[model samples]
Target: MTANTGFLERTFKLSERKTDPKTEFLAGLTTFMTMSYILAVNPNMLAEAGMDRGGVFTGTILASIIAMLIMGFFANLPFALSAGMGLNAFFTYTVVLTMGHPWSYALTAVFLEGIIFIILSFFKVREKIFFAIPTSLKNAVSVGIGLFITLIGLTSSGLIVANDATFLSLGELTSRTSVVAIFSLILMAILTAKNVKGALLYGIIAGTVLALILGVTSLPQGTVFSLPPSISEVAFKLHWDNIFTLDMFSVMFTFLFVDLFDTVGTLTGVATKANLIEEDGNLPGVGRALLADAIGTVSGALLGTSTVTTFVESASGVAEGGRTGLTALSCAFFFFISLFLFPLFSIIPAQATSAALIMVGLFMITPITNIDLEDFTESVPAFLTMVTMPFAYSIAEGISVGMITYVVMKLCTGKHKEVSPIMYVLAIIFAIRYLRPILPF
Candidate 1:
């Protein structure tokens, strides 16, 4: 091996994980393709909250690059971090627009949440919570995230649409987007069945080509590369005027709560799918991963975005044979390059990536067989964890519901000994969080 190759092997332990540079690079590319939609989506969403669109765009990329690099170099995990989808919506719709807080004020809340996360991670509080989770719940989290990802794919490809009457209904199968996504899914399935490498990546490329041919998407009209926009308007713009108020606490708590469990769920689910979890049900280097995620959130808020957490799309990489931080390093490198090639990356239609997400979802759900079905106590919470994710459209909510139900089931069945102390505390905390909306206080 060359000196550069040897250095990389020592840094990321590529051989130790049974993944070569080629496979890791391909996995990272697949992951980036599946999640590159955030480049457009995050800026657009945050702009609604009165933040500068260009600044938010730049901030999003920078934060992702930094966090992903940390994940690669520090955590040695394959996960990619970025501005979270649901948390961004809350920052825009619920925090600023609904609560009437200034955009700067909202950013402050996010910053505070990150600080708290860092402290928790430093103390290994997050790690303890992770280890405390039951193996059944962990498997269920993987299954739940699978369904959630598939739901996102279906919606993004226009195969699923919101219905005014029944909540969700199927879209026209003949539509260009849905047709392309379906074709890509089939192609990927064939490739996967044949044990082909980079199946998801090939499927996304094929789908994008088909989308262009069918006029569902178009190539960029001008030069594909350009300088990124300035973040002067949004970077370091947090406000402290409302920091001491009850409203601020509520907003920050919401950010912390969602980000905390969301990161936990993503780590649990994706790590499980990657087979990184040990026989004892703990993931090695997870504390470092949580610290990386916390740093991402803090840096994201400073740079003008919402919470930055691990993307479920990283599962696409794991599904493609990624097993080390080299995959994350590849993603970080591509994110840096994207600053100049945003237009090129943007041309990849959502329908293309949707197929990859759906395929990754299939890979993630395989752990369901590990859950004990004969035992009602274990099966009930596990089943709830699997179904609630897609139904509630929130990974954290699925985990919260699962934990609460798991605790209650164990306690009522005279099996409380099976529940860990941390699990009990977490259940009570989640219960109070849910009840806060109904509480008079």
Candidate 2:
């Protein structure tokens, strides 16, 4: 065997997936194409809360590289990690601006959250929680996240429009962008039906080209290569003053709650989609994934960015037949290379990624068949999970609702013996989240 091939086989067991280095590379590129928008969007958002745009930009990319590598090497899974979307908004707007906390204090809170996560992960508390979840709900989480991803893709591609009456309506298909996205979806469906290897990746590239040609999206104008911005302005700038104060307690708890549920939901959803969950519903190497996420969050705070978490966009790579960590490793390399080639990332229109995400979302739906519909106790909660994910616009929210409903159904049906202790704990936590707004404490 050749040296590179031998190394890949030994490290990632690429043979298990029947995927070669080239396929892994393409899958990685496909994942990056879909997620690279964060490289721009995160900085702009954080800047509104008093962060340096350039520093946040640099920190975002660097943290992604580190986290992705750790996930690749430690978890041996095809997941990618980066600064999360909603959490960053909370970090900037709610924590820093609204709460009147300094940006440094926000970073310190994130740092504390990360340390807490590390401790939890090391003791396998996070992994145990995964195991404690009922199999029916685990399957529901997977299907729920799938619907959530589809919602994101459709809205992002302008195939769906916001409305006052129904909350959502059909977009103008006559619009060039929506039309192009429709065509892209059909093309990807055809490729997948034809059993094309890396069909998702191929579709994304083709869709981007088609969008560019049809004037559905404008090409980015900038230098193709440039030096990365410096992170020194914000790096290692956390302030721990009053960290133990009551005010900081709420800030830290908020960070911990959101991060924990988000990570759990993402991991469970992605593992189910990729078929990485054990027959017993346990996710192998999950501790590593959790550790990678916690380390990423900590490093992001030190390097000057918001909390980092596993990207749901990694499902796009899995849909492209990426069954090993080589995909994540390859993606990490692209994140580093992107420091110079970032302008190219902008040229990939949202329609292309939306197409891929929508298709991957479709692939993740098969797990729903595993739910026992005859059992009302299982079916109702499962249905709640599937619908609430998209309607609520949050995977974690869907999971919370599902678990809460699951526990309620069990107790009401006198199936309390079926409910694990962790389920009760989660229900209480979800209760606290709901009560947060009204609690005078």
Against the correct fold, how does model 1 do in TM-score?
0.98
Listed in order, each prediction's TM-score against the native is 0.98, 0.95
| Local accuracy of candidate 1 as per-residue lDDT tens digits, 115-226 | 9999999999999999999999999999999999999999999889999999999999998889999999999999999999999999999998999899988999899988
lDDT of candidate 2 over 1-441, digit per residue (tens): 999889889998887757788878877887887898899889998898888998998899999999988998888888988999889998888988899998999989988889999999999998888889888988898888888899999999999989999999999988878877887888889989999877777777888888888886666676688788899888999997888898888888878877887788888887887888889889888889999999999999999999999898888888787778888988999899988877777677787789888998898788888899999999999999889989988877888899999999999999999999999999888978889899986
TM-score, structure 2 vs. true: 0.95
Which residues of candidate 2, in runs, are more than 4 Å off?
Answer: 435-441
Question: Ten consecutive residues with minimal summed lDDT in candidate 1?
Answer: 238-247
The residue-level lDDT of candidate 2 at 219 comes to: 67
Clashes of each: 0, 0
Prediction 1 global C-alpha lDDT: 0.94
